[model samples]
Target: MTPQYMNISYHDLLKATSGFSSENVIGTGGFGVVYKGIMAVEGIITSVAIKVLNLEQRGASRSFLSECETLRSVRHRNLIKVLSCCSSIDHRGNDFKAVVFEYMPNGSLEEWLHPKESMNSQPFESLSIMQRLNIAIDVAAALGYLHEHGPVPVVHCDLKPSNILLDNEMIAHVGDFGLARFLIRQANISSPSMTSASGIKGSIGYIPPEYGFGSQASTEGDIYSYGILLLETFTGVSPTDERFTDVSSLHSHVKMAFPSRVLDVVDSKMFLERQCPGTKTVCAPKSAHDCLVSVLQCGIQCSKESPRERGTMKQVVRELDSARMLLLR
Candidate 1:
C-alpha cells in the first residue's frame, strides 16, 4: 500500500531549511539541492533532508512528480524513506515544490567510495569487504522490490553510487528517482516518456548499451547498472573514472585483470583492511578473497552487453547471498 503523503507548508519548509542557505546544503544534482534541516514535527524536533526543486531546470517538475508517485507506493528497508513534501507556492508567488526525507547521516555511497581529504588531511575509512557485500545486497533487494511490484515492473533509469545513501548505522538506502520509469510490458519496453522528450539514457558510464541505441529501459538495464556499481564497490573505481578510454570502461578494466590479477584492480587500502582485519575496516574470514571473486563473476554476468545475457535480479540476489555466506564461513 502507498504510504500516506504528508503535506508540508512552504513557510515551514523555509523555516526548516533556514531560508535554504548554502551552509545547510547536503547534496545537489539535476533535480535540485538537498538541505539538512531540523524541523519540529508533532512537537518533537526531527532531522530531515529537504530536496527543493529547481523549477528553472527542464524536467525538474517531472522528476519531483516521478519520485513522489514512485516512492509513494514502494516501501523497503533498503529504500530511502519519504517523510513528506511541500507543493505550495513560495513567498514570491512563484511555483514551489520540495520533498522531505529521512536524513541519512552517512550521506551517499559515492562519498564513502571516493572519500575527499578531510579537514585534518585524512580520508574517510573505506567500506570493508563485508560492508560492501551487505550494501550490494541491500541495493539488489531494493531493485528487486521495484521490479516485482505493481501491474508493471519499475525500472530505475538512473542507478549510481551518488544516488545510494547510507544511514548512521551504515545501512544503505537507494534514493533519487528523478529518472525512474515504469516498464510497460504490454509493448515489451519502457514507456516512451523517458526517450521521447529528452532521450535520457542515464548517467555516463552507468548507462546500458541497449539504452544508447534507443532501446526502452528494462529490468535488465537496471541489472547492468547494478553490475557496474558492484564492480566499483569492490575495485574502488568509478565508472566515470577519467582513465577509461573509448575502448574501455570500469567493466572492461576489471575484466582484463580478473581471475589472474583480481587484487590488482581491487582497492589497495580496502584489501589491506580486509587482510589485516583489526587495522582499519572490519575483518571477515580468509574466504573473503574467494567470495569476492564469485561476487565479481556475478557482476560480470549481469553487466553483459546483451540484455538477454544478463541474469535476473532473483539470480543476482541469490549469488550475492552465496558470496556473503562464503565470507561468513
Candidate 2:
C-alpha cells in the first residue's frame, strides 16, 4: 500500500530541526547531510531523519528527485519509507530540498561493524553471530524484492553497510536511494543505462567490476555490492582497507583464507563471544563453525568478479536461511 505523504513547509522543517542545528546532525554523505528531527504525523509528533540536499553540489537536485521517485514507487519493510518532501526556498532565498524518513534509532550497520570513539555515545558492543545473520537476511530480502517482486524493479545502485540502517528492533532498512534506477524490462532483457554518465554511481570497493568497464546498472551489480557487505560484516574489515592495495580486493582476500582458514580472518570479537567458555582450543562449536563457513561461502559466491557468476539475492537469502537453521539446530 502507498503511504500518505505529509504536506510540510520550509518553516515546519526549520522548526522540526532547530534550524538545522549542528547538534541535530546524524550523518553526512556525498549529496547531503541527515538531521534528526521531530514532526507531526497523523497528529502524533514523531522523530524522523531529514536528508537536506546540497543544491550547490552538482547532481544533488537530480539525486533528490530520483530518490523521491524511487521511494514513491517501491514499498518494503526492509526499505526506508519516505514520509514527506520539501522543495521550497529557504529563508535565505536559496533553493531548499529535503526528504523526510522514519528515524532509525539503532543507527547503521557500519557503526556496529566499525565503531569509532566519537561516533556513538553508548558503550560499544559487538554484534553477535545471530544478529549478523539476521541483518544479512533482511538486506538480501530487501534487494530481492527490489530486483524481482516490486511493482517496478529498482536498482539500488548503492548498497553498503553505511546505507543499511537498524531500527529499534535491529531490523535492517536499506536507505539512500539517491542513485536508484528503475529498470525497464523488455522481454527477458533489462534495459541498459549507466547510473552516471561520467563516473561510477556507487562507492569505491562496493562497485561491481563490470560497472568499471562501463556496464549499465543492473540487479547483478547490486548483488555484487551485497556480497561485499556480507563479507565485511563477518570479517569486521573495510573493503577499502589500506592492506587491500594492488590486485588484492576484499573478495580475493577472503577467498585466499576461505573454508579451512576462514576462522583466521573472521571477526575476533564475534568468534570469541561465540567460543565455549574456558575452552583453549581454537575451534568454535561445530554447528557455529559450519554455519560460518556456509555464510562465508555465500559471500564468496555473491561477490564473484564476474557478474554472471554471482548468485541472485534470492539464492543468497536461501543459503543464509539454511545457515541460520544449522546454527539453531
Candidate with the greatest lDDT versus the true structure: 2
Q: Any residue pairs clashing in model 1, and if so which?
A: none
* Tens-place lDDT digits, model 1, residues 107-186: 78888888772111234687888888899999999998888754446888889998999998899999998788865444
The alpha-carbon deviation from the true structure for residue 89 of candidate 2, after best TM-score superposition, in angstroms, is: 0.5
Number of the predicted model whose TM-score against the real structure is largest: 2
Give the whole-model CA lDDT for all candidates, comma-separated. 0.82, 0.89
Give the total clashing residue pairs for model 1.
Answer: 0
Give the distance in Å from residue 156's predicted Cα in candidate 2 to where it truly belongs: 0.4
**Which segments of model 2 are wrong by more than 4 Å?**
188-200, 274-283
Model 2 lDDT tens row, 117-206: 226665558998889999999999999999989987888989999899999999999999999888777765554344344434899989
- The candidate 2 region of ten consecutive residues with least summed lDDT is 191-200
Per-model TM-score on C-alpha atoms: 0.90, 0.94
